[model samples]
Target: MAKLLGLDKVATFFRIIRGNGGIFGSVKTLFRTDELKIGNLIGEDKYGNRYYENNAYFVGRNRWVIYADKVGLNYDGSQVPAEWFGWLHYKTDLPPNKDPSRPKYKWMLDHEQNMSGTNQAYMPYSTTRPKIESWQPPQ
Candidate 1:
């Protein structure tokens, strides 16, 4: 119960100091009021992302992935790779490890988490000069 309150950790002291003990942590914390998902952890990937499946399927779907990082700072759809995305969204019945048909082509590049809004974003070269110029100061 103390853990649910975010009061049990020494790290919480630092977070409290950082913010005078206002609301901290995240949406996942609400669901993790108990350790409901911890025991159901079926697999972890190289990046420390964990995968789970609840046996109780409302229709026919029972798969989910929890990232190591919380949703706010690290949240982005691009963090999920193509292969794992397939399994997460029910496009494939097999996990990446167990799937034999997954390829190992030499020409293929490793997947990178997206960098669209960051400094690593793709920039195309322009062949044409800019039509509009800044007004030159009188000199």
Candidate 2:
């Protein structure tokens, strides 16, 4: 019972710090209560994303992902691999590891996290010269 109580308190702390549960979540628990409670770890993808579920919470809201990289909390939705995405959304009952129907076609591409705001972000190359020339006071 004491351990349970301690866990509850911890959960409340995270809720308050993260502001996950909203005003009531913050004021009441001071931590995301849901986050603190232990949940069944569903699976982890190749990219280090972890999926978890707790039946105590509502079905849709119970499932969540703990991102592998902090990335300043700027993580994008695309970071979730295709297989894990299905599990998170309730589209499939089985996780990628257990799914029998999952395909392994040669053409299928590997998963890659989004790099939108980083130095690795996509940059297209063009051969055309600049339309607007730089100004020159005097040569």
Prediction 1 TM-score vs. true:
0.60
Clashing pairs for model 2 are: 12-29, 12-30, 12-31, 13-31, 14-31, 14-32, 15-31, 15-32, 16-30, 16-31
lDDT of 2 by residue, 1-139 (tens): 8576698777755654564346554444323233444367888887777788877788898888866654435557898998889889999878888888888999998988788788999999989999999999996
Segments in model 1 whose C-alpha atoms lie over 4 Å from true places: 1-28, 31-39, 57-61, 70-72, 132-139
lDDT of 1 by residue, 1-139 (tens): 8788776765654553443223344334434332222224556777667777766554344676666665444556677778888888878878887888888899998778888888999999999998997999999
Clashes of each: 0, 10
Model 2 has a clash total of 10
How well does each candidate superpose onto the true structure, as a TM-score?
0.60, 0.63
By TM-score, the best candidate is 2
Measured over all alpha carbons after superposition, the RMSD of each candidate to the real structure, in angstroms, is 9.6, 7.7
